[model samples]
Target: MLKDKVVVITGASSGIGLLTARLLSEEGAVPILAARSRQKLAEASSGIAGKHEIKVLDVTREDQVKQMINEIIADHGQIDILLNNAGYGQFESIVDMPSEEFGRMMDVNYMGIVRCTKAVLPHMLGRGSGRIVNVASMAGKIGTAKSTAYTATKHAVLGFSNALRQELRGTGVTVSTVNPGPIDTPFFELADPAGGYTSNVKWLMMKPEYVARKIVRFMDSGKEELNLPLKAAAAMRFYQLCPRLADRLTYRMMNKK
Candidate 1:
């Protein structure tokens, strides 16, 4: 089903986004790599074998998001998929986190998704067939210490996806969310500069390729949500069912950073 499809993937410069672009290319899909770095996007596309395009986009900017979407539609005639994968996090307690940093995180993580989705929705709705996949995190499902800002952004993403999915029902456009646990990627360099959280959970870290494959599957699965690392998904469900007990246990486990 993905063959010959035009996929627009934000954050396509690296990590799961880049990997998924490669996989989609392998499946004969035309992946449009979108990111803020033109150099990085070029480098990422150079490695893929099949047809692809790269767009310089800063999702935080409404103008850029709108322009990118417009250009994609103009060039491709239609966009079959939109993968909102551009986001970052900084792990810090609320007291220590700078207000500016929190706002920036919100802008890039949550509002970025909003901007991109709003820009692309009109095109998708007109065509009456498109898939919108959002890359949230396990943090969104279960809050932990030192992740107030990051978790809040992801929680907002989940809420947005859920509501948007409902709104898009019967419109032939679907909204899907990918909630993955810690993956081995450069993201932690910024999110955990101290390297404490990475070290503490190194054993549980998943490879970017693993998560990327799951994301590719989700693009056409018609599923609403994809939570990774069976164990983490189970834990999220447990937390929802037993907030008090899970809070004590999860806090002890996640507070090691």
Candidate 2:
């Protein structure tokens, strides 16, 4: 379904973004790989077999985002899909977390999605068809200790996507979110510098390729929301229905990080 379509992916240099780009290329989609580092973006797209483009983009910057979107439109005629995947996290208690660190996370994880969506929306609306896939986290649904700031940012992402999806009801523009459990990615190099969370949840980690395939499937299907690793989704649902019980039972697990 994505064949010959233009798909712009933020954070396309590595992890899920890079893996998804490869998958889209194989499906005959024109993947526009966008990331902060031009070198990294170029290197990431080097091995892809099908047609793709590399554009340096930092979703946190409004001007850069607008210009990049305009350039893509000028080059590709229209962008069929936008994958908002540019984000990072720092896990720490609210008291121990620097205020600036929290703000930075909000800017990238939440505001970055806002900026890119805003920049691309007008074009998508004009064309009357487009797909926006945001990569959130399972943390967005269930808050845990040490991830207060990160969780808040993701919650904001989910909130933004929920509202936007409703607003675009008949506009032929769709908003979908991917809320995945901890995936084996370089995201932890910074989110869990002490290696505590990584080690604690090593067994639960999902591979990036697995998550990437799910993302591609969502793009084709236009599913409203996708929660990875069925077990995690069930746990999130249980936590929602019984917060007190969840807290009592999962306190030890939550504190492992």
Candidate 3:
């Protein structure tokens, strides 16, 4: 149960993270909101029914992450869960995308998770009880157009989750990863300046609230590797099995990224 449990969430200012911050708090969980945008985090904090912490954090900076984690641990006494969800994707072709931009993506989307995990692992392992939920994307499993760097980071998230799961096998701590399909959230707007997109036609496009509810539910279940919107997972697998035929049928006919 999430009730009264202290959980720290990153990338918590908007979109799925914001929805989760509110959801968890209402369900009786103590949410510690971590993000770079103080204004946004403050605004999000207002929506929750109960008290929650708002910690300003820039995940790309390891020093800040270390200090922030230690501060939360110091204040809260115990960190029950760490939600590694702070990330964004840049829409561009690999050739035209600046290498520096790609590096920035890895720094936040991949290294950020790494830094936070390292900061919390000792405490969790020492206590022999904790939960770490990482939010990846469908792009982690299937290739998407215009998401080369984003896809790479998400893929790295998958690898990181798998390895960490193995390392914590005997410990009381639990690690779970979620791969969500297209959700009707600010992410698409953040990724594209345009108002309309056809690529998001599939799966009825879940809402952020829906995703958050499912995540909290799964957390209660003590599950590993939640493949959300089951149909998408099945389709990705089916596409992979078909090889070039799938690529030609799926990507060859659609917009890149």
Candidate 4:
């Protein structure tokens, strides 16, 4: 269904972004890979099949983000899909995390999506049809220990996506969010250096390819929200229905891993 579609994916250097690019390419999508590292982007694009492009972009920088969008349009004529997947997770206690680190997290994870979305929205609106997929996290829906900064940014992404989805009701532009649980990617190494969290939930962690395939499916289905590993989604829903019990249950689940 995505064949020959002009899709742009940020954070295309590794993890979910890189895998998603590969899956989309197999479906015949022309993906433009974007990341802060040109070398990394080149390496990731090298293994991808078919004709794809690359852009060295730091979404936090408004100028670079805007330039990338303009260039993509100039080169491809239109952007059919945008996967705002450029982000990182910083797991640290609120008191231990420096204010600058918190600010940086918000800038790259939250504001970065805002800037990229803004840059592409006008063109999508003009075309009267487009797909936007924001890769948020399950943490966006529920907070966890040592994830203050990361959780806050994801929450912002969720809020932004929700508002944007409602606003674009009649514009023919659709917005979707992917709330993935722990994925066994390099992301965990940085997000949890101690490996405690990952080891505990090792069995539950979804594979990057698994998450990527689901996301690719959503792009065509126009699914508003996707929560990987149905069990996790059910737990989150239970939390929504009963905060007290859910909180206690989450604590137990985390430690049980």
- Per-prediction TM-score, please? 0.98, 0.98, 0.93, 0.97
Q: lDDT of each structure?
A: 0.92, 0.92, 0.85, 0.90
Return the candidate ranking by lDDT, descending: 2, 1, 4, 3
Candidate 4: list runs displaced more than 4 Å: 255-257
Residue ranges of candidate 3 with Cα displaced over 4 Å: 196-204, 240-245, 252-256
Could you tell me which residue pairs clash in candidate 1? Answer: none
| Every model: Cα RMSD to truth | 0.9, 0.9, 1.8, 1.3
Candidate 4 per-residue lDDT over residues 1-257, each given as its tens digit: 89999999999999989988898888999989999998888899889988788999999899999999999999889999999999998688888999999999999999999999999999999999999999999989888888889989999999999999999999999999999989998887788888888878878889888899998888989889999887888887887799888888667565431
1-257 per-residue lDDT for model 1 (tens digits): 79999999999999999999999999999999999999998899889999999999999999999998999899889999999999999988889999999899999999999999999999999988899999999989888888999999999999999999999999999999999999999899899998999999988899999988888888868888999987788889998899899998767777866
Model 3 superposed RMSD (Cα): 1.8
* Model 1 regions lying over 4 Å from their true place: none
Please give, for residues 1-257, the per-residue lDDT of candidate 2 as tens digits.
99999999999999999999999999999999999998888789787889999989888899999999999999879999999999999888889989999899999999999999999999999999999999999999988898989999999999999999999999999999999999999899988888988898888899999999989988999789999886788999999899999989999887767
User: lDDT (0-100) at residue 121 of candidate 3?
Assistant: 89
Candidate 4: residue 88 Cα off by (Å): 0.5
Backbone clashes in each candidate structure, one number apiece? 0, 0, 3, 1
What TM-score quantifies how close candidate 3 is to the native fold? 0.93
